[model samples]
Target: MSTSPVHLWGPVRRAENDGVRLAFDALTEGAGGEPLLLVTGLGANRYWVPDGLCLALAQQGFAVARYDQRDSGESTRLPPVATGNPISALFGRRGAAYTAEDMADDAAAVLDALGWGSAHLLGVSLGGAIAQRVALRHPDRVRTLTTMAAVPADVSGLATLRYIRVGTLAKFARLRFPDTADGAVAAGIAVSRLLASPSRPFDENAARADALRNLDNGLHDRQAQSRQIGAQWSGPRIDAITRPSLVLHGQDDPLIKPTAARAIAARIPGARLRLLPEVGHELPARAWDTIADELRTLAA
Candidate 1:
């Protein structure tokens, strides 16, 4: 099924943090209702939320806002990798460093700039790691939390395996390719092929289109990806979070194993976990209805 084109309404006044000015798109059904803030994963722009999912949430009476993180999309870019290695930085060795807490702070700053006291927060993959930190660090700013395909503090089992594979691949890519146009194209092709696998349940045309759009948008800044990767490797402790939470995962996710979701749910007190059998790492456009229904339930 095809989704209606997304209608974005903003170059809204986003707060500046850490030498970066945030940019966000806000969709509201009305003035008085629960607001939902979406955070994207590593190497992703706001569009990664998917038009269908955003529209679904809007239809469910939520005022949703999705933004480009500091180094992705139209947001600011950090200096090129010079002395510090991006891969080493991820493992907390020796490099330019920023924690998921810092990212969470950025989110809070966005909320402040928008005059929102509190809102439901939803994040996917690395974004989920940031959301957990946000809810833990700024408990008052988050009403409800949903973490999709993320891991908690201690990395073990399949989550560790996935991280090792992704980190190693990313490191190799950065050292060898280093953001060249050709590298971007190659990466896009690889991603497209991976997502087109039968277990992924995605539209190949749309996947390719999104991949090329991302490349065209220059969304693969190495420094930003490095910082984000660092945050994910050493994520925050979620045990302190008291907010009602939902953890969603695809049983067939190749990148982040389903057990990671179980671990995340285990850490957050009383957090609910839902596992879908066929979905993979990428959130399919067809799952918009399921995502919307889940978010609505969380908001309620």
Candidate 2:
């Protein structure tokens, strides 16, 4: 069997959003295919998205790009404010830094920087929520929307908790490591292992390599994660999204429940929902091609 082209990631580029600078990188320089932006999960750097998935999508005729959201990775970090705990912040009414609308605008800014009029957006975890907001806030700039292992954008407070596995979140507090580059790698591996599917063998080697390569992984920043989760959305609901939408969630996802995806797909008119069995919060290498194929069909 012929293998897919290995996507060579371009150097990190900057996209200015207001005063904040968002960091992003394209799959390669000259693919000239459909633009597809991959939004990373909460506090995750662009490297969290597997290169294998990007390669698979590239083979399917997508010019893939991934970006670090505000307060994550190389993106501009706002001054820290008092955010008790990230878990509490997830249920908080006010954001310590910015609104979710501002976060959505950041995606538009990246698109403007790339000079793409509109592009398909594929987001996972917290990124999925941001992608939905982007579609609602900047409908004209999105061709299609895909969310993986995400909750409904409209739900918040106690309502949001219904879709989350509280026990899994508690594990974040238990993660203990020295505050250093090596610690970041260790934390990354712990988080990755925690989110990996129970049915599959966790790839600690690959995770270690990725963590070492992207030493700026923001897994240790609880307050930043707080600000990210605490950012409230005042815009139209996910049902207001008019673009083509797909909601994919892992059947065995230990973070957000598959019901969250179902809720999203049900709310967004004509949105397709796919619950991958034996999968988890993290994207396993085995499911890369299947996801890419689904995205290809969505773009078509």
Candidate 3:
């Protein structure tokens, strides 16, 4: 298989609600008819949408668009950490301060900027949370929904070792080495380790290379990561999503547990859930084919 990275680029587009501009990459041209919008997870840029996955989806006749969430990739960042702690904003007693609803609005604004009235939506992890909110709040903008390794609010015990390790390491690394390139390298290594699975080992070297490439590409904007994390909405509100949906989760996922996926599937009316035993929190290269197949099936 060719490992050449898919080239994607876009100029910033200002969101209508706020002046926040979102950076996105679009893979168009070969798509037969349906357009797919991919929302990435926290701390990750559009590159997290694996190249193989994108090519597979493209081959299946879907124009795939993946973008950095606000505060992460090429997107806008929130106010400085001194003004407010983004993490605290999400978990405080104010009941999910920013909320996934706002994120859904942001996704809608992206589609509007693209001149697409509606499209298929796919989100991973935290991105899935935002996508769910989008589907619930703006059903008219979504043709179908596919959430992978995502959970709803009120769903506790959703963290995996990968999540814990990455979160802990990133926090500590930032505090100790804030202004150094080593900090970024260390953080990338931690994420790479966390994403690797024993049963389905990923190419750590490749992951590291990609991590560095992503960082060099100006895609690793830390402030944006904090903002996206701060904007999360937790609880059982996923029941309101009435669109045709598919939830994919790895049985061995260390971050959001499989049960979280089950809960999300249960709440969504007529949603389909698929559990893969060999996969993990990170989508391994080996499993791209299976995931792509499922997504194509759902899109069809």
lDDT agreement with native, every candidate: 0.69, 0.87, 0.67
| Best candidate, TM-score | 2
Q: Quote the positional error of residue 52 for candidate 3 in Å.
A: 1.1
By summed lDDT, the worst window of 10 consecutive residues in model 3 runs over: 154-163
Number of clashes found in candidate 2: 0
Model 1 lDDT tens row, 1-300? 113344345445557787778778686443255788888877677766676677778888888887777767667666654424445555544334555566888899888877899999989877888888888888999999998877774453244554334743453454434476666655655554453325754555665666555562333455667655655334446787899999988776666667788878988999999986677666775567888799889888
What candidate 2 gets wrong by more than 4 Å, as runs, is 1-7
lDDT of 3 by residue, 1-300 (tens): 123534433444454547767777676445455778988877676766777777777777778777767666667755655314334433341223345557778898888877789999989888787888888788899999999877774332333232333454344334422334655655555565664554676676776676665552222444444455555454336787778999998877665567778878888999999997777777777778887888888877
**Maximum-lDDT candidate:** 2
Error of 3 at 109 (Å): 0.9
List clashing residue pairs in candidate 3: 71-224, 72-224, 153-234, 153-235, 154-235, 160-254, 160-255
